[model samples]
Target: MERKKFLRNIVLVSLAPAVWLAACKDTGKPAAQAGEQATYTCPMHPQIVQHKPGTCPICGMDLVPFDKNNKDHSLTLDNSQIALANITTMTIGAGDLAGFKQLNGRLATDPEKTTVISSRVPGRVEALYVKETGVSIKKGQALYRIYSEQLASLQQEYLLAVAQVRQFPDDARFAQIEKGARQKLSLYDQSDTDIQRLVQSQKVDPYVTYPAPQGGVVAELSVTEGQYVTEGGAIMRLEGYHQLWVEADLYPAEAVKPGQTVKVIVAGWEQEPQQMTVQFINPALQSGSQLMQLRGTIPNPENRWQPGQQANILLPVKSKNDVLTLPVDAVIRDGKGTHVWIEKSKGKFEPRIVATGMENYDAVEITDGLSAGDKVVVTGAYLLYSEYILKKGADPLAAAAGHQH
Candidate 1:
């Protein structure tokens, strides 16, 4: 009996630890579950947060698990999200803002390079060598053929005068008459070569062919085949593409004047920018517009560029040196005002409202809310702004305003 009693005591003592271990595990489960409690938030409408997985009532987007403890205005993105958003940062410091004022402009035909071709005599068009507009013509190229009774009579008179001059070489009266006839033919658009050909062929050809006086691209064809043209009437219009005019609009406040050299970047060929001098700035505003006209000339020696092409002019503005500046895209502007996303820590970003001064095409002046050596989100700032709104259910600028207050 004594041995049995001792064995029972040992068994009870051993069982006591097992019973306590079981109770401890049972009580710890609920506490662990409470610590692990998760909340869900809509990516698009973070205001719709719930303790369970469901769709957002406002935006109807699927709710995603979010850290409820993240109450600050700053946002944190993982490596994958950062890479997916293409977020990039740059350290800003005091430096010269080497920026350009971009002005929209277009290429145009230089009026000084345009020419109008006209007929020297009334005639009936027999044929056209260049039949259509936009045809390229070279010097001495046959332009058209014309048939006229007047031309035929002039050729006959020229032939008679040449024959008389050959027969009566000593007679001054015949020589004078020959010279007058030759001059008349010359006045009627007859070249020396045409007169020599007529004298050689000894034929009264009623149809005469005319040659182009210069090389150009035919811009307009006023006369067609079988169309009669009168003396001094327009036959065709030609334009030289050796140079083009670049015209842009400038506001009254822009400090641009004639003789200023500016950079011109042709659309689709931005790699090769040309330097052009500002030739004219209209003293008065354009009709029905508040902007003034800015004109410049660009050389197109290869004729590769066409008129009416979109172009951009880069005008240099007075740069502010030793100033805080950031990429133009780094700043965000909305109804909440202007702010920039700054790196508070690795993978963490916060919005800061900043006062701006002068700005240019590539950079903006940061007058307040930032200091030198601050890392700024230069790319994908809008993505961060969006993510902040998605995760925080508020505008990043709103937080900035709150801090300011």
Candidate 2:
């Protein structure tokens, strides 16, 4: 029994050290060494974090240290990552955002410059010099010959009156009658030389040739040879190719008043773009299209600007100088609103919701939410947006507080 008690005492002595150590053990978190307390997170995936350095599970990129100094909702990039993304920045300042606005349009014949050739007297078309449309004719050139019984009867009257005046030289009534008949023939497009010839020959010509009043290309032919026509009947349609009208439809957002300058670029034309003023602006919007119509006149001395061809028009609807502006790529628009990315510090960026006004092809106006000298992302902004969406798994502007000015 004494020997058994000795073994029990020895076992108790071994247990005493373990019991003491247990009593002194710490029940809190593990203590970190000096300078080893930094937390790490994925640069492209901000939600992923680790107590020690590691790689990101989603993108397999090396984990980066968290900048506790940076506020939430700000993205931080290193020099290497910035170079890889080709990120660039610009300082905001005052400038003109209204250079010009581009639009698509088409060229058409100017109605004011179009002319219609018509018969002055009732007659049958004896012969048509212009056989088809598109025939170019010069001013005073013969276009057609017409047979008019009325004109022939007037010629016969003038010839007979002239003979009576010669027979009775002292008769004032006969001389007055001859003068009246001569005036009647001259009123039917008959020149003094044509009347003199008729009086000399004493014969009635059955047909008379009519000349083109203006130089232009024939756009339409209404009457054929042997066709009978009445007074003031349309013979042919002529259009002066020296000028053309470029017509474009303007939306309500791009409406402009008259006298605004427009630059026109004609398709397949080697000449430089021509500039013209807005000639017409419709007061009411079109029914189906909801677009307002406007037009400009373009000179076509060489006939290079053809009707029915496509044209691109740039209208300077409005312009303002000394206004805050930014590159068009800097602004991002979504359902939340328009916003831009601004660099708060070196390699650190934050989204700023902005109110925008006029915008052109290259730049946009920043009406609110920013001041002069603010650095903004001009290039590679979309890449940053993608990173933000991937990291947060949501739109950057989804939160109402994030969009608050």
Strongest candidate by TM-score = 1
lDDT of 2 by residue, 181-216 (tens): 988887788998898788788889968898998888
Give candidate 2 misplaced runs (Cα > 4 Å): 1-98, 169-172, 252-255, 317-405
**Global lDDT of each model?**
0.88, 0.83
lDDT of 2 at 72: 68
Candidate topping lDDT: 1
Candidate 1 lDDT over residue span 1-405, tens digit each: 999999999999999999999999999999999978888877766567778888988878888786666668788888899999999999989988766889999999998988898887788989888889888989889898888788889899989988998998999999999999999889988888888999999998878788888889999999889999887889899899999999999899999989999999999887788999999999999899899999989899789999999999999867778999998899999865999998889999889999898887567899998999999999999999878866665667888888767
Clashing pairs in 1: none
Q: Work out how many backbone clashes candidate 1 has.
A: 0
User: How accurate locally is residue 255 in candidate 1, as Cα lDDT from 0 to 100?
Assistant: 93
